[model samples]
Target chain A: AQTVTQSQPEMSVQEAETVTLSCTYDTSENNYYLFWYKQPPSRQMILVIRQEAYKQQNATENRFSVNFQKAAKSFSLKISDSQLGDTAMYFCAFVTSNTDKLIFGTGTRLQVFP
Target chain B: SAVISQKPSRDICQRGTSLTIQCQVDSQVTMMFWYRQQPGQSLTLIATANQGSEATYESGFVIDKFPISRPNLTFSTLTVSNMSPEDSSIYLCSVEVRGAAGNTIYFGEGSWLTVV
Candidate 1:
């Protein structure tokens, strides 16, 4: 069984600033994928960024990036130049190569204050 | 990227009733998944729907409670049978699409069911 943990229940960031949301997971599988999903007020789940466990380099998507430390079992999401639209509930997810089922964290409620 | 749509975006049902949610995809897919998101919580996989076969359920889920149907590649349906307050959660339909690195899962808007 695999589990994802998001220690921070809530977080706040000032507009135009940067914010980092922490995430950790426990999985025995070597080949896996990590993802960060954003659910806005509209209740639409949007993919923020994803990182492959085999990749040493972090994944960056415009303003969203991930700091993936495979040895530490840590995958954190960083939002740079944050805007009000970034305010949402962020969830960290894990999926193994064998089974495509996703395991998600509790989520971090992020508020981008102007 | 494929577009997934779920019907009856939301509904209020009485206990002991059943609600069947429909999911349609723009492209053909091999696997379709159903998930449940409780209020203020993360998503949990309910079952995996595959065309031409019975659905595979997760540990805590059973076919009697959540009956799923996948008659083809681009469509599936999930029915919440004998609903209760505990079943009042957001039901989402998802499909995996191949991405640059690997497969990425995309979710529908979700069907919000409120049982009283």
Candidate 2:
């Protein structure tokens, strides 16, 4: 069974500051994928970033980037120069190549204070 | 990137009634997924629908409760039958977009339902 864990239930960051959300997963498969998704108050989910297990280089999208440690089984999302609009619930997800099913962690509520 | 749209963005239904949420994607996709998100909780996958086969439901979810229909590559529907207060949730639709690197799942805005 593959399970994703996000220890942080809530996080706060000042505007223009940085914050990192930690995520870890347990999976026996070598080939898999990790993702970060953002859900705003409007109840719409947006894809933050994704990292493939085989790729040594981490994935980055604008101010959102991931530090993917495959051996350590850790994948964390780092938000640089955070803005007020970044306040939302962040969820870490896992998906294996064999099964397209995506398993999600509990979630970390992020609040960016101005 | 595909544009995914869901109908009845929000609705308040009486208990024991059934509601069918429709999902439409601009581009053809092989796999369409249905997910449920309870209030203040993470998203849980309800089932996965393939165009030609029966839907595959996750462990706790059954076909009778969440009956899914995938008539074509670009359209799918999920019906919540005999709804209750516990069934009040945001039902989301997702599609697998195969890219050069790998397959990425994109989500729709979601249909929020409140059972009273």
Say which candidate scores most in TM-score. 2
TM-score (all chains, Cα) for each model: 0.97, 0.98
Write the residue-wise lDDT of candidate 1 on B1-116 in tens digits.
Answer: 77999988999999999999999999999879999999988998999998999999999999999999999999999999999999999999999887777878888998999999
The whole-model lDDT of each prediction reads: 0.93, 0.94
Off by over 4 Å in 1: none
Docking class of 1: medium
lDDT of 2 at A58: 93
TM-score of chain A of 2: 0.98
Pull out the clashing pairs in model 2.
none
Q: Which residue pairs in candidate 1 have backbone atoms (N, alpha carbon, C) closer than 3 angstroms, thus clashing?
A: none
Question: What are the per-residue Cα lDDT tens digits for candidate 1 across A7-91?
Answer: 9999999999999999999999999989999999778788888888989999999999999999999999999999999999999
lDDT of each residue in B1-116, candidate 2, tens digit only: 77999988999999999999999999999979999999988999999987977899989999999999999999999999999999999999998888898978889999999999
For model 2, what is the error of residue A3's alpha carbon versus the real structure, in angstroms, after optimal superposition? 0.4
